[model samples]
Target: MPMDRRSVLKGASGIAAASTLSGCLGFLGGGGGGGNQGDAMLWHAMTESETETFEESLSIYNDENDAEIVAEENGDLRNNVETTLPTGDGPEMYRWAQDWAGNHYQRDFLYDASDDIDFNLEDTFSQAAVQAITVGADDAVVGLPVGGETVTLLYNKDMVDSPPETYAEMESTMEEYHDPSNGQYGLSHPIDAYFVSAWMHAFGGYYFQVNEDGEGVTGLDLDETKRGMEFVRDSIWPYVPADTNPGPQQAIFQNGSAPFAVNGPWSIATFEDNGINVGVTSFPTVDGNTPSPYTGTSMWYFTTRMADDEDRRESALDYAKWISQSEERQRAYADAHSDVPVLNSISAEDLGDQVAGFKGSYEGGIAMPNHPKMGSVWTPTEDAMNAVLQDDADIDSRFDEAAETVRSNWEE
Candidate 1:
C-alpha cells in the first residue's frame, strides 16, 4: 500500500511525542523556557525528512543571526491553530497550506505583511504561489509561499513504451489492459474530487469561482460539470476498481498491475521504493484541451500574536524571508521532500527529473482558492461523486443536491 499523507503524519506524530517528552523533562530540570513566552516559536507538521532539513537550516539561521527561534512539531496542527490562534497564545509563526490564508485572515488570526516584507512578491515566487497567498479586499499578502505540489500522470516505464498524449489513446490503452478477473487495470486513481479535478477542468468545469462581490460560488450544478462526471463514469470507471480509496487505487499501480496512475509527488518515493520504474508526465489532452489539476502551496504564516510585538514580528519576518528566499534552502526542501520550489530562481532542472516532469502540469494547473467557502465545497463534492460512481445514482440530480448543500453549508 502507498504511504499517503495521513500515514506519514501519523508516523511523524509518534516521533514528535518522544521529542516532546524529552523537552518536558528538560524544562522541569531548569534548562527551560516555558511555552512560547520569551522566544519566537514556529509550529509545523512537516514529515520526518522535511523536519530534519528545516531544523538544519534553522540552526544555521539561529547561529548566524543571534535569533532564538524554536521549532515545535504539532500532530493536529490545523485544529490547534484554529483553536489557539484566536486567543493570541499560539506560536508566532506556523506552516500550513496556502488555502487556509483567507480563512485565517478573515478570522483575524493572520498578520498581513505586504508592506513589511522586504522582497517583491511578483519577482520572488511563481504566479500560482503568489496568488495562493494573496487574499481579501485590499489583496493582503498573508503568507510566504515556500513550496508547491500538484497531481500529474505517473506511469510504469516497463509497461508503457510512452504515455498517451490524448484521452482517446489513453482510453484505448485502458481497454487493452483492463481485466477485472485477474485484478489488473490500465489506469488507477482515487475517485475523490481532488484527484478527478483534472477531468472536470478538461471539460471546462470548475468547483468554485469568485464572483463580482468577491463571494465564492459553487459550480457543482453546471452543465460542464455533469459532462465531466459522465465522462468519468462512462469512460474511466469501467476500467478501475470499485473501491474508490486511494490505497487500493495506488496499490494497483505500485504492484505493477496498472500502467498509469494519477498522483502527486508524495507517492513517488513509495513507487520507487517498491521497485517500480516510475515516470512522471502531464495529463493527456481531452479533445485539444489540457487537463488542469489544482495546485497548492505550503507556506509559513505569521500570526496576529507576532504582529502585536514589534521585535517578534521583525524576527519572524526575517526568518521567513531568509528561509523562503534562499535558493540553497529551497533546493534542500526539493531534494528532501520532493517539494516543488516556489522560488523563481530555482528551476525544475535544478531539482531533478521528477520535478522537471511535473513542471508542465504545475504551470497549466489552477491555484486552489484560498477563500473560506472553499472548505464547504470538498465534502459535498466528494459525497456527490461517490453517489454517482459507486451507487450508480443520477449524476445531474446528485450534483444539484451537492450544489445546494454547499451553498447551505457556506451560509452557516
Candidate 2:
C-alpha cells in the first residue's frame, strides 16, 4: 500500500533525527545500472516524509506509463553525484538544490531540458523557481523545480501572542525574554552567511551580484554589507547565545527557552514534534525594508547519463514532466512535508497556514545566486561573521579581509 500524508508526517521527527546522524556518510554503492541502463534512476537525499510522497507519485506515474523510474536515497547525494557523473556511473537524474545548476552545467554534467522538453517552463513554475535552474547564456534550463524553501521568523505561540512586525519590536521582545543566568534567550539565529543573507539584503547588500555579463561580482566589502553585519553585532547579537551553530540555536528554540527562531521549513516538523506551537511568518522589517532571505528550490536535474541515449532521455523527461505538471502530486508533497510547491496551479490557500507562511516568505525572498563562484563566497563570509559576532572583531577589517580571500579563491 502507498504511504499516506499522516504516516509520513508521523515519521518526520525520527527521519530528521536519523538524517542528522547520517549526514556525513557517503553513498554505500551497489545501485542499478547507469548510463547504458534503459530504466531511469534518480538519486536523492530526501527525508523520510519527502521520499514517501515522492515514491507514491512515482508509483502512480510508473503504473500509467511505460517508463520505469526508481529512486535511490543516498546520504551523501551531492558528493556522490560530483564524483561519479564524470565517470558515467551516476544515475540518469538526481534531486538536489537548484544552486548546483550552474556548477553542474559548467562542468558538462547536466542535460539542458529546454531544448527537448515540451512543458512550458516559465508558465508552469514560479518565476524564481524557473530562474533558479537557468544557467549560462540565453537562460538554458538545467533542471525542473518541484518545490522551494526560505528562512522565516518562527515564534512560539504560547510565548508570543502575535509575531513581531518590525526589528524594533523584535529587539524589545528579545530584551524582555533574555536571561543569561537561566540560559534563556529571546531569539535563536545562526550567524552563518546563509542565515545572514536576509540581514544583508535588508541593508541593500549581497554576497554576490550577477553583472551585465552574467558573471557574479563579490560584494563582501560593500559599505552596506558592513552596515548589516554591524547591525547584527550591535542590536541582535547581544541577546542571542554566543554559539552560532544551527544545532545549538535550534535546540534553544526547541526546548522553549527562545521564543523566536529564524529557520526554514525543514525545521517545522522537529519544532512541532517538540510540542512547540510554532507560527511561521516573514522576518520583521528592518527600518521599513523587508528582509529578503535566500530562496532555494529543490529540483530534478537530468545528468549526462541520459544525454546520448534517446530512449533513456525521453523516459527521464517524461518522468520530470509528469511529476512537475501534476498538481495533485505537488500538493501531496506540500502536505506531507510542508514544502512551498513550485507549481503555479497550487495556490497558497490550497495548502495549510504553515505552507502559506513559507510561500509568503519565498515570494519576498531573493533567489539565491546559482553562479559557480558562489561556492567561493561562503567560507570567507562565515569567517567574517564569526569574527564580528563571536570575537568582536572590527567589521570593516574583517569584511575587507574576506573580500580579498574570496577574490583569491576565485583566482585559484
Kindly list the per-residue Cα lDDT of model 1 for residues 155-212, writing each as its tens digit.
Answer: 8999888888998888888888889799999788877777788888788888888888
Judged by whole-model lDDT over C-alpha atoms, candidate 2 comes out at 0.77
When summed lDDT is taken over every stretch of 10 residues in candidate 1, the lowest stretch is: 22-31
Candidate lDDT (C-alpha), each: 0.77, 0.77
**Candidate 1 local lDDT, residue 60:** 94
The TM-scores, one per candidate, come to: 0.90, 0.90
- Deviation from truth (RMSD, Å), model 1: 5.8
How high is the lDDT of residue 81 in model 1? 80
How do the residues 293-366 of candidate 2 rate in per-residue lDDT, one tens digit apiece? 88878788988887767877788888888887788887877777677888888888898888888888888898
* Top candidate, metric TM-score: 2
